[model samples]
Target: MVLASALLATLGLVSPVSAGASKGVELGASDTEGVTTSATPLRGTRGVSSYEGTGVPSDVTAYGAQRVPAGHRIEGYSSPTGDDFGTQSIIGADGRVRVDPTTSFPARATVLITRTVSGVERLHCTGWMFGASLVLTAGHCVFNQSTGWYTGQLRFYPGANGTTYPYGSCTAATLRSNTGWTVDGSPDADYGGASLNCSIGNTTGWYGAYWTTASLNGTSTTIQGYPGDKSQQQWIHSDQVRASNSLRLYYDNDTVGGNSGSSVHTVRADGSSGCSGRCSLAFHAYGVGSGTHNSGPRITESRFNLVIGWR
Candidate 1:
C-alpha cells in the first residue's frame, strides 16, 4: 500500500499545566473544552479514504510510530515473519487476526471515528465507547499536533464491519483533549474524548478504564480498531505488555495509522458483561520508532475521571 506524503503543520505549544503523578499535563479550564483553533487538524485528502501509515508488529514499515522503549525485550521476537512485516496487513503477520463481534468480547464496544479535517478533508480513526454517550481516543485524532487545527464534524460507527454499520453511527457533539496536546504538543498528553449526540452506548454498552504502576511484563493486552489500511475495517491483535512508564504502555500488537486512538486493554480471566474479557489499560496512539513495539497514553486516575465525567 503506497501512501502520499502528508503535509505536516507546525505544532503550536502553549503553557503547560500541572499533571500530578502522571506525565500528562492538564489544560486550563478555557482550553479543556470543545475543539480549539490552535489544535493541529487531523489530515487527509478529499479522495483519501484510508490510513496509509504502518501499524504494530516489529517488522512492518508503516507511516505510524514503531519505537519501543530502549532495551525492552518482547516475547515474540524469535523468527520474525508475516504479511511482509509492513505490507498493509490489517492483522499483523505473526499473531493479528480479523475479529467477528459475535465471537469477541469488548469488540462491539470499539467504534470507528470519522471527521472532516478543516471541514473538507475526510479522515477516520479508531475509538472506544466508554459511557452511555462518550468515546475515547488519541488527542491527535481530533487535534492534530503538526497542524494546530481542530478537526470538524465527528461521525462514529459502533460495531462497524466492512460497509455494514450494525450498531449505527452518531455525530460527535463535543471533542475534548488535554492542554498538553493543544498547548504544549506533548504526546504523553495524547488522549481525547467525545460526547455523542446519539445513544449508541446504551445499545452496545461501554468499557470501564483504569490505570496502575504495577509491572505488566506478562499481562495479556488486546487492541481492536478500524485500521485505514484494511479499508477502515475492524481488526484485532492480542499480545503481552512489554514495557511502561508514567504515561504510556508498550506492546507488540499489530496496529496501523488508522488504529490510532484504539483501546489497548487487558481481558479479565473470568470474563464478564456477557463477553469474555475487558479493557483495563491505555488508549493506543503511536508506534514506537527504532523500537519493536506500539504505545499508548497510559490512563491515570485523574485521566480516568476526566473521561468518565464526559461519559
Candidate 2:
C-alpha cells in the first residue's frame, strides 16, 4: 500500500478541537470534584474528527497499566528499496543513536526515546522539540504494529555539544500520529508530530529552552538529526530546505534513521533570528522529518493541531 494514499484521505478529515482546547498541555489548573476551573481554554483550529469504534490494540490494553523502563527497542525497519528508507544501527553506550560520519544536517531539536514490547524495552528513537511542548518525529520511531505505543522515557536536547548540556527526559503520557501512517509503510507518516510535557527539568536537555512557532507553507527551513547508521555518530549542520506537497521535506543534505522526528525550523538566508529574510517571507513550521520519502505525504499543521489536544 502507498503511504501517501492515506494522506489524500486526511485532507477531508480536518475537524475543530473540542471547543476551547489548546495544542498540548492544558493552560490552567483544575479544582476538586473533577471540575476544571481554568480560564478560557486555549483554543485553536479543530483537528480531524475522532475515529469511531476504534479500540486500543490488545497489546497496548494489556500493558497500559504497567510502567515500562526508560529504555526500550522495537523491532522492524523501513524497507530501503521502496519510498520508505532507513538503516540498521544499534543504540550506542551513551544511550543515543550511533552516528554515521558521512551524513550531516542542521540540527534543531534533540529527542530522547525508549521503546518496549510486552512491557520489555525493545527499541528507541530520538525526537525533536517544536512548540512549547510539541515534538516532531517519525511515526515509526515511537509506534509499532506489535507493541502499540512505545512508552518509557521521552527527552529533548537543544544542542548536542558532548557533555556541555545534559539530557532531559519526560514521561510521554499521550501520543498521536497520522491515521494514514498505519495504512502503509511510507515515509508519508514520517512527517509526524507529537507533544510532551516535562515535569522534571534537565539543564543538559531541551525543556528549559525557548521555542517559537512559525507558520507553514513556502518557508525556508533547516533540520538536524542523529543518523546512527550514517558516517557520523551524532550529526549537526544546516542546509537550505524545502517542503513538498506531500508534506515531506526535500533538502540538499542527507538524513537517516534516528533522525526521524527531527525538527524542521524556519530561518533566513543570512541565518538570523526570526523567519523573515530579505524577501517578504514569513517564517513558520515547514515540515517534520517523518522518514525518507521521495513521494510520500508530508506532515501538516492541521494534523498536528489534532494531536496537541491529546497531550
Candidate 3:
C-alpha cells in the first residue's frame, strides 16, 4: 500500500542523485516498491484532449488546433528570465518543433512556469500536471539557495502557446520540494511540485508517470514544453533514451533554458506492462554536463510515490 501524505512529507530528500549525476546506482526494494510497476498519474480528459498530429512545430506558428476549453479559470515572471535555475540543454541541431495545438494530451498537461525576475514576470521553467491540483517541476524552479521558496513568485499556465492560454492558469496554494534540494542542494534530487489553488486539471488533464527497474535505453522519448527562446510557445522534440542510470536518464532531445522541469516521457502503447499512453520517465533539469547527452532526474519507486502522496 502507498504511504500516507503525512509520512511522505518527511521522506523526501533523504538522498539527492541527479542529472549529470556522479555514479551508477543499484535498484532496491524501493526502486520498484516491492512490485514490478505502478501508474500514478491522472492522464486524459474525456472531451478536452487537443490534436497532436501536426503544425508549425518550433516557432513558425501553426494555428491549426487553437481550440480553448470552456469553464476553467485563468490567472505572472523574473531573472534574465531563467538564469541559474533549471537549465535545459540543447543537443546538437535544434530539431524541436512547436506543438501545433498545445491542447493535445501531453501538451495540455504540460505547463509553462514563470517567475518574477529583475522586476518583471518572465518565462522560467516548464512543468507537467500529474493530478487535479499538482504540478511537478524542478526544485530549483520553485526554490533557490539564496532566496528560498517562491511562494508568491511563480505561476503555472497549461497549454500556453504564445499569446494563447487555452486552459487558463493556476497558482500554488503551497510550494513543495524535497530536502535533497532544499537542504542538500543535490541536483539528482532536484525534482519538486506544487499544489494548485484550483482543480483545473479536471479540464486540462495530466500526464501519467511510472517507475521501472528495467534498462530504458532505446526507449523512444519525447520532451514537450515551453522553451524560453520560443517566447512562451510550447515546443516538442523526440529522441530515444540514450542512457538509463539508477537515478537519471539521458537523451539527445533538443531543448533550451526554460524547458527545465519538462517531462521526459515515452508514449507507451495501450495496455503496456507498467504504463500506457504518454507516460513520464524523468524530470528534465540540467543541460549536457553529465556527458554529451542532456539529462534529468529519473522517476524511481520512491520519487513516484512521493509525487502521488503530494497529490
Best-fitting candidate, scored by lDDT: 3
| Candidate 3 ranges with C-alpha deviation above 4 Å | 1-88, 117-119, 289-291
The best candidate by TM-score is 3
Candidate 3: lDDT of 220? 91
Best-to-worst order by lDDT is: 3, 1, 2
Looking at model 1, residue 203 earns an lDDT score of 53
lDDT of 2 by residue, 1-311 (tens): 11242344345442323222234212211111121322333233112211111122222213222222323223333324323233222211112323332111222235434444465532255555433345556667656566565555443433333222222234464565656564554555544445555422112112111122333344444444544342222454434434455345454334444555555444333223212222111111122233532122333443443443343
lDDT of each: 0.59, 0.36, 0.69
TM-score for candidate 2, residues paired by index: 0.47
The Cα error of candidate 1 at residue 109, in Å, is: 1.0
Q: Which stretches of candidate 1 lie over 4 Å from their true place?
A: 1-94, 101-105, 117-123, 146-151, 269-277, 289-291
Ranking by TM-score: 3, 1, 2
Error of model 2, residue 269, in angstroms? 9.2
What tens digits encode model 1's per-residue C-alpha lDDT throughout 1-311?
Answer: 00111111112232222112222122212111321222322222000001111111232112121222322221111222323245332234545577664213366678877765454523368888776577889998888767754535567766666555556566677888988788988888899978777665655556645554456577788888876655445778888888888788888887767788998877553323211236457889887544467888887655654664565
